[model samples]
Target: MTSIIVFYLLYLLSLCLGLACVVCVCVWSGHWRGGFAWDGSALEFNWHPVLMVTGLVVVYGVGAVVYRIPLTWGQNKLPWKLLHAALMLIALILSIVGLCAVFDYHNINKISNVYSLHSWIGITATAVFAMQWVCGAAGFLLPCSPVTLRKVLKPVHVWLGGIILLLSIAACISGINEKLFFALKGNATGTQPYSSLPPEAVLGNTLGVLIVAFGLVVLKILSNHEWQRPDSRPEGLAYTPLLQEENE
Candidate 1:
């Protein structure tokens, strides 16, 4: 619980910082109405806007994934039924890719419109995730959770998640492939830099990292892998809470 709070706090704090940077950029861009610096360079130095938004969004996405464990560990756990899991899983993937896209700006010329590709992927993934969220929200509410709705949400949720996961992986792979191609061209620098990269790109990169982290954690929990099994569960026994509770 302490750890969860820390991660969430970090995510929120980072976001606030990002917002501040965005404002700084906007202010710098507009200059003073009364008498502004005629120098046409305020916007250029304000790369923090890009950095803050991208970095913090990624952090937040990661926090979502990170926080899931505490969520599941509670007394009356919120069951992320397979269908609901799809919603979270897709959101994480989109978030990761969105971050990666932004970070790809420096490499855009090398990768050729990675920003566009990422944008499309992010938008599509967000749409599917939003749908999943609505359905999942309904599922959580007793009255709103209609059988027909579950039927409708379940299959669609899986389909959307599956596509988003596969495509997001593809997009991440593409970014790496682009870098590899660059390396092959004899430009050996691994990190790409761009003069005009927007705050959105950083937002995308940060998001990508965080979501990847979150996804791994969630998947690990879902598997209930050997590492996470409770002490009471006989060596190889799975965690069937009722059986354990009854025994206790």
Candidate 2:
């Protein structure tokens, strides 16, 4: 019961942090630096951080915890799995849009793309996530997959999902830092001397902290073996033998 309570609390905290991150981005871009736009302008760049936080951090976090939700434990795993996949699919689409926004803005303005560490890591993480989703669908959702294959892929899927979550969060932090540096230095002019913190800088830093906190809480919940859902089948009839055979 305590574990369950902790789970919900952490879940709530992560969500709150996610929302805070989005709000921070909106305030930083909309209120501080004009507003967001899709056409070739600095405003178009705003969509990058906003969509990334919404899709990669918030939506992905919810999908990660879907299996751990207590209410879904008594039901068949397939429905939960489908729900998870659907959420992740939406996340993937949003992430793609975010990536495209940045690339388009850069191309239109003749700015170099994928040159920074943040861009490199973000692109790599996004690629891995896409692969993870495809592999998960093929291995688990497809009816043609054998039970042995499914058992073998389960742990890998879980671990890779966690890794991708961390990677995405790391990319977000780096991206935030990069943008803050650009803003503070006054793009192409080098006006300010990194002395004091502006409101936008403070907001960006807060967003980064919230993102890190959310990732940590979600990962803690995911890593707790005790919080894992039990099999819906009778204990004796569970797929222990199949798992063991695959392990062997």
Q: For each candidate, what TM-score against the reference?
A: 0.36, 0.90
Cα deviation of 76, candidate 1, in Å: 3.7
lDDT of 1 by residue, 1-248 (tens): 56557544544554454344345334432431112221233232223223322322333233334323343443332243333344355544545444444445335334434255644654465555556556655553344454565555645654554454444434443443332333233235433443233343343344345444433443333333332213333433222321123231
Where in model 1 is the C-alpha error above 4 Å?
A: 1-119, 139-142, 182-184, 187-248
Candidate 2: residue pairs that collide: none
> For residues 153-183, could you state the per-residue lDDT of candidate 2 as single tens digits?
8899899999989889999999988887877
Best by TM-score: 2
